[model samples]
Target: MFGSDDFKDQAVWEFSFRIDDGGFSWDYKFKPPLWKSVVGRTLSKNNDVLLLDASHDEPTDGREETSAVFQSRFLEGIGPIKGVIYGYHQGPEVLKATGNQTQLKNWLRDQTGVRVYRDNVRVFNYGEPSDDWLGLNVRRINRPGDRFGTNSLVAAISLDLESSYLLKEKTNREGFDGGGAFPRFVKLVLSAFERFEHVAIDDRKALDDVIRGKGTAVAPVRFLDAMDSLKAGVKSKNIPKAFQREIDAIEREYTELRDVMVSAGTAGLNLAVIFHEIEREVDALAAAVERKLDEQSIKKQIEQIHYMLHGFAPLLRKNPAKSIFCSEVIEQATRVRKSRFAFHSVVFSAPVLTKEEPDFKIKAAPNLLVGAIGNLLDNAMYWTKVRQELDASNGSRAIRVFDSAQGR
Candidate 1:
C-alpha cells in the first residue's frame, strides 16, 4: 500500500505488529505490516505533515471583485468530516490563484481549522513548465504536539484498523463508527504518561545534562533555583533527584580531600615523635659534653645541635599566638641550619640593629612564622649550592635578610 500509488489513497493487504523485551510484550492485529522503512520514519517523525494533490498558480494581476451571490445550500446536508482533506485543487479554480503557497496554507488554516505543517514541505516540479503539483506526506491522526508511547500506539492501531476496513471495500455507507470509549481511554493513558515523564524522564535528563558538563552555562542558576525552592518549602518533583545526585558527587570529592589531609597530618605527627626522641637523647649527651671542655670540636657540635633543637622545638609544643618580632623568627630559622652555612661556606648577612630601634612585629603563631622563614632559606640554599657548583669563582654564596628600620 505504501509503495503503490493506487493504494496510497486506499488500503493495505495486511498489517501486524509485535514488540517484546523479555519483561514486556505486546502484539497488534496486523500482518505483512506496512514497509518497515515507511512506518519507522513515520513513527520517528510523529508530527510531520504530508500534503497531497496541491497546485501552484501565478498571482492575480489585480484585486478580484468579491462575489455577493454565494450560497450555503451546498453545505446544508453535509456531515462533519473525519478524514484529512488536502487543500489542493484541480484546474484554475483555486481562490488565490497567484497567492504564495505559505499564505494559502495560512488562509486554509484560518478558514478550515486545519494545522498546516511548518517544516519539511517539499515541492516537486517534475522538470517541466506546466502547473506545479504539490504533495505533503504526514501522519494525520495524531494530536499536534503530544508525543508518548501510548499515543503513538493508539495512532498506529487506528491506522491499522482503517487500513483493514478500506481493504474490505468498506466506506462511510457501511456505518462503521468508533465510539467515545476509545477517546476516553486515550485521554486517561496520555494523562498518566505525562505525569510519569515529567518526573522520571524530563528531570533525569536535566540531571544528566548538568553532570556531563553539557549544561555548565545553566548549572549555577539551576542550583540556585533548586536552593530557592528548598528554602521556600516549595515541592518540585524535578529538583530533588538531581539535587541528591549533585550532593553525592560533591561529597565524594571532599571525602578524597579529607582523606589526604588526614594522611598528611598522621605523617607529620610521626615525624614530630621521632624528633622528640632525638631531642631527649641529645639533651643527655649535652650534659655529658658540659663535663668535658677539653673536647672543643665535639662540644661545639653539641652546641650547634642544641641551637637546632631550640629553633624547632616550638613547632611541636602547644604555643599560643602572640605578638613577636619578625627578626626572632629569621634568627631561629637560621640558627637551626647554622652548621650547614659553615659546611657549605656560604656567607650570611643581616642588618645590624640596636635595642633603641623598633623591629617589625607580627601577631601570629610563632611556629608559622618560623616555618615560613625556614622554607625561604631552604629554597635559597638549594639555588645557592647550584650556583657555586656551576662556577666556584662566581662570587661568595650568600643569603641576606632585609627589613624596614622603622618597623614598616
Candidate 2:
C-alpha cells in the first residue's frame, strides 16, 4: 500500500520508527550513518530507529538482531528516492493511517539488513521547507544556497535542511561525525532530485569562483592537517578519544564522497560549471520577474540584505572568534520586503544577532550563510545600479543603514 517515495524513506532508516494511530513509519534522517562503517568506521553510535532480528539464509536460518540499521539489501531494493535525504515530515494522516509495524519490520530485514524495535523518542516533524533543504545539504552541495542566491526562495528551503538534519546531531555530540550520515544522504538526494527532473544542465564549471557562502558549507580545508596528523599519531598510540574525532570526520567525508560519486554518474561536476549555470538560470528568472524594477523596489531588497549582514558583523567580532562566516551574515543583505516598512525604498538587515555577546560561542561556519547573504547583496547592488538612472535626470538618491547598532 505504500508508495515508492515512502519506501525510499524506509530504505534509508538506520533504525528509528514513529508511533502513531495504527503503526509506525521509519525516520529517514537516521540512514546515512550506517554506511560509515563500510567506508571508514565512525566513532559515533548509530541513530538507531528500528530494532531488528535478522535471520540468515541457512535452513536453520541463524538470526541476529539489530534495531537501528539499513541492511545493504534494503537500500538496494527501496524506491522513489529524492535528492539525498532532506527532512521528511509525515503528513498527520500518514501517521494516523494503519501501518503493519510488524510486517514493515519483516520486510526491512528480508529486503534490507536494517531492523528496528521501539524507543521512547516521540516523532517530531520539522515542518519548514527551509529545514528540509538544509538536511539535504548536510550531505550534498557544499552547503545550501551555494548554487543560488541566498535570499532566493531556494535559500530559504536550504536553511531548513541545515536546521532539521545537521544542526541537532552536531549540537548533541561533538563526535557524532563518525556516525553522521546526514551529509552523505543529502548528496544522494540532490543527485536524485536532478536525476528525475531530466533538466539538461551545462554550466557548473564556475562554482569554484562562486563564494556561495557559509564557512562550513565552503568545503572546509584546514590550514594545518591537524585532523589527519592526529589520526596518524593515534594509530601509533591507542588514544581512544583523540583519534575518534578524526575517524568520525573521515567516515563522514568518505560517505559523502561516495554518495556524490554514485549520484554524479551523468551530471556530476565540480564548481565552475555549476556556478555558471546557476547564474544564468537566476538571471533568466530575474529578467522574467520584472520588466523595469524601479530603484525603490530593488533597493529595498538590497537594504534588507545589507542590514542583516551588518548585524552579523558584530556577532562575528564577539568571543570565541567565530567569524560571522556565512555569506549572508558577513556580507550585506538588501531585500525588497513584500510590504512597505518605515523605509519604503529598501530593507536591509543581518540574519545573526550582533552587539551583545552570547554565553555560548558560535562558529559562524562561513560558507553557506555568508555566501548566501553575499548573493543577495550582489543582486541588490545590481538592482541599485539599474535604479540609479534617476540621478542623471535631476536628483541624487542616498542609501543608509537602518540598524544603528550594526554600525552600517
Candidate 3:
C-alpha cells in the first residue's frame, strides 16, 4: 500500500500509519483502501495525511461498541492508528536563502485553511477562500489575537467511518449530513485549534522580540548601561569635571528651548484658526455685495446694509475694551464700496460728527467691523444701480452714513 505510485508522487510533510490486523496476517500486503487511493490522487505536494486502521471486528459477545465510545477511543491514545503528529516551519536559514519572505508568506496565505475528506472524497465549500466554514474569520474579526488567520494555515482531517456507520455525507457534498457524528467532528477540530492558538501566540511574541532587538547587547537597556559604565570610568580616571558640568548645563538649556518651541507651535495653531474665520466672513460679505437688486428699492436696501454691518460688530470685538472712533470704523467699513460706487457713478457720503454730539468711540474688532459695514454698502450700491437703470431720473445712486453715541 505504501509503494503505490500515487503515494510516491505526492509530498507528505507529515503522516500517521496504523493497522489493527487482529493478528490475521503480518505478511499480507493488502491494497490501499478506497479513501487512501482517492487521497493519494487528490492530495497536494504540500499536504498532510492521517491514516487509520479501525478494521477490528465487532465483539462476539453481542455488545457492540457505541459510536460515541468509538469516537472517544479514536481521540484517546489506545487506537491502532495512534502516532505522534508533527508540523514543520521553515527555519531562519531557509528563509534567508529564499531572500523573499514576502513571496513565501503570500504563497502560504494562498494555501491556508482547512479541507475535510470523508471516505477519500474531498468535502465541498469547507476550504474555499471565501468560505469561513469554521467561523475562524468571524472570531478573528470580533476578537482579534495574534493567532492564525485563514491565509496562514493549511490543514486536512481525513475520517474513515465505514465500520462505525454513524456518519453520512450530504447529497449536495457540502459536508457531512446533520447526524450525530457531525457535531462531534466539528468539536474535535475546534478543540485542537484552541491548543494550536496558545502555541502560536508564544511563537509570535518570540519573533517580535527578536525583530525589536530586545534582550540583546544592542537593546535599549544594554545601551543605557554601557553609557553609564563609560561615565563611571571617566570619573575614576579624574577626567575634567568641567566638561561634565558643561554637558549638564547644555542639556538644561535644550529642555527649556524645547518648551518654548512647543508654546510657539500652539500659538501658531490658534492664529491659523483666527485667520480662517476672518477669511470666511470676508467671502460672505463679498458675495452679498455682488448680488443684483430691483430698481425701486433704494432706501430699504440701505437699511438692510446698515443692519448687516451692525450684526458684524460683536464678531469684530469679542471683548468690550477695544475701542475705535465711530467715524473711523464706518470709513474703514465703507472702503470696500469705493470701487463699486465709482463704476455705478454713485456718490458715497460719511457725515462729519458735530461738536455738540461728540463722535464717540465704540468697542469692536477692526476687521469684522469694517467687513460688516462694507457688505451693507455693497448691497446698497447694487440696488441703486438697478434703480438708475430702471429710471433715468435716478441716474446716480447715493449712500449716506450717520453714527450716533447710542450705537446705531
By TM-score, the best candidate is: 3
Candidate 2 residue runs with Cα over 4 Å from true position: 1-24, 27-408
lDDT of each: 0.38, 0.32, 0.46
Greater TM-score among 1 and 2 belongs to 1
Q: Is candidate 1 or candidate 2 better by lDDT?
A: 1
By lDDT, the better pick of 1 and 3 is 3
Best by lDDT: 3
- Residue 60 error for model 2, in Å? 53
Span of 10 residues, lowest total lDDT, candidate 2: 53-62
| lDDT string, candidate 2, 1-408, tens digits | 665456554421122222222222332222221221222111222232222211111111111111122232222211212112222112222223325444444333333211111132212222222334323333235433233211111110122232234323335432223233433333323333332112111112121222233233366566246567767788778788855876877867975675444334212222322344334335544664476777776665555445444443422321222544333344323222212122224444443434342222337433333334444443443344335532333233233323344564
**TM-score of each model, paired residue for residue:** 0.30, 0.20, 0.32
lDDT of 3 by residue, 260-378 (tens): 55444333323333343344445545555566434335445455456544534433433323688877777655543443355446787776433334577778545545545655665
> Residue-wise lDDT of candidate 1 within 1-408, one digit each (tens)?
122232212211111222111111122111112322212111122111111111111111111111111112211112111122211221122223323434443433333211111122211211122211111112121322222221112111112332222112114422222232222222222222232222233333433343345653553556546555554552444546666666666666765665455444433533433364346447656776677645765666577566766666765554457998877877766776665566456788666333344467889767656666665775676567555544545577898776765464
* Residue 408 C-alpha lDDT in model 1: 48
Clashes in each model (backbone N, CA, C under 3 Å)? 13, 102, 3
Ranking by TM-score, best first?
3, 1, 2
State the displacement of the C-alpha of residue 292, model 1, in Å, after optimal TM-score superposition. 10
